[model samples]
Target: MSYEEILLETEEKMEKAATVFSDELKGIRTGRATPGLIENIRADYYGSPTPLKQMASISVPEPRMLVVKPFDVSVIKSIEKAILKSDLGMTPNSDGKILRLQVPALSEERRKQIVNQVKDLAEKAKISIRNIRRDSNRQADQLEKKSEISEDDCKSLKDEIQELTKKFEDKVNEYFDKKQKEILEK
Candidate 1:
């Protein structure tokens, strides 16, 4: 592949890694309620597992409360069961048509734990970005070996890839810091 193609592919992959990390952070509970936390919860709908976002409407009626109203009333039980099955550690209070989830205050220890989890996720994203850089470097080296690119051009391409890796790794760190602050907030 050409140098430009290799660089572009590397950047796109790194961007995707950062985005995935951000989305995952949204699912990690904080001191408040948010639709993102439970929207991805899978429930049995007609014997098939389906995401809660597809089966219900989730609203944060209060700072610490989420109201879930299923379009199909019959799925209320399934939704409740899904919440119970999730790692969220909260039970859904259901009344036929709607379910209410109360997001409890995070203890100091829990907040620390969540922060640690965020750190782990951020590290994983950085690892993914670095892997992309490695692959792009390899492609550049191959091009140099084949004489498709001059030695200087290959070295320049590797430098560009390294810069992209640093940029994306910084973005991941930014997201992690933001999420850690959110989780630790009182």
Candidate 2:
């Protein structure tokens, strides 16, 4: 509606892009076990697809192992089946009630592939942030044309939006670098 509103919207979207990138990076496999990898998986629960976190309690008893204890023992088989079918590539060792997944070490090639994927994701986030900046700048121009905002106000708003974009882009780059290090660590 106004230049200030446009800037706020742009800032909000930039932050959202950063948050999304961070969440996705958590799912990338590394050298250790973490709840983020499988917590969002959709497992068949009585003909309905449910998030694994809701169906089971996941814990990392060791650095390389994940113990998944289902709230309903009857769902253990379903959970196992889901994990087997998923791209996690880890075998599920089920013992009637609880399931264990042994997270394996990533090969050098796999680590490189994952790093490339992270780079791609980071690029996409940056592009999205840039697009938001463009749209906000365009809106500011429109407000100036309509005399709702002075040219000086529009210029200031665009500058603020650009700063927000740079801040979020840096955040995305920071996430990429951190994840890359985690994936490559021995």
Candidate 3:
């Protein structure tokens, strides 16, 4: 394959790495209520475990409140139990039809802990991006050794891959900064 095609593929992989990191960040909790918090919750519905969103309609009734109205009223109890059992540290209040979850204010220590967690996640994302760059660089080196691509062309491709890596790393840092600010905000 041509150097151009190889660079294009590398860029696509880098973009995918960034997307995965963004999805992971969404799963991290903030002080405010967001529908994404429960979107990943798995509930036992009709003898099958499925995502909570598939079985209920989740809404942010207020900044700190999440309301889950289940399509099947019978699953209300199961939903409540699932949430209570989850790592979110939240208790669900159900009135035989819908479940209400009130997100509590984070303590100072809790906020710091969350910030640390966000930093850890950001570090992992950076590592993944770097891995992609390493793989692309290896491929470029192989092409250069095989003489399928000229030395100049291989160097240029490596430079482009490095730039892409830096761009994605910046994106990860930006996300981490925003999340850290959100966690530390009063």
Candidate 4:
């Protein structure tokens, strides 16, 4: 592939990696109620493990309350069970027709722990971005060795890949900072 193609592919891959990292970060709970918190819950619906959002309408009834209204009332028990079993430490209260989840306030210790976890995730994303840059560099080097591209062209391609890596890393850090602020806020 040409230098331009390699750079574009690397940029695209880095962007995807950053996006996935951000999505995972959103799943981490803060001191508020957010749909993302329970969107990943897998409830046994018709013998199939499906996401809660797929089977119910989730809404933030209040700053700390999440209300889930299942289209099928029969699945209420299943959804409650799924939520109770999750590591989110949230309790689900079902009243025949709907489920209510109250997000507990985070303790100072818990907030610190979560901040550390977010930092670890950010580090992982940075490492992955660096790995992509390394792979792109390797491909450019191979192209240069094969006489498919000049040394100067290879250097230019590597520079572009490095820039892309930096951009993605910055995005990851920005996401982590925002999450940290959310977690730390009382």
Candidate 4 least-lDDT 10 residues = 86-95
TM-score of each: 0.99, 0.97, 0.96, 0.98
Q: Pick the candidate with the highest TM-score.
A: 1
Clashing pairs in 2: none
In order, candidate lDDTs are 0.94, 0.92, 0.89, 0.93
Query: What tens digits encode model 3's per-residue C-alpha lDDT throughout 13-74?
Result: 88887888788877778899999888888989989998899999999989999999999898
Q: Quick one: best lDDT, which candidate?
A: 1
Candidates 1 and 4: which is better by TM-score?
Answer: 1
Q: Could you give the candidate ranking by lDDT, starting with the highest?
A: 1, 4, 2, 3
Model 2 worst lDDT window (10 residues): 2-11
Q: Candidate 1: lDDT of 90? A: 93
Error of 2 at 74 (Å): 0.8
The sequence of per-residue lDDT tens digits that candidate 4 reaches over residues 52-166 is: 9899999997999999999999889999999998889999987899999999999999999999999998999899899999999999999999999999999888888988998
| Model 2 regions more than 4 Å off | none
Q: What are the clashing pairs of model 4? A: none
The total number of steric clashes, by the backbone 3 Å criterion, in model 4 comes to: 0
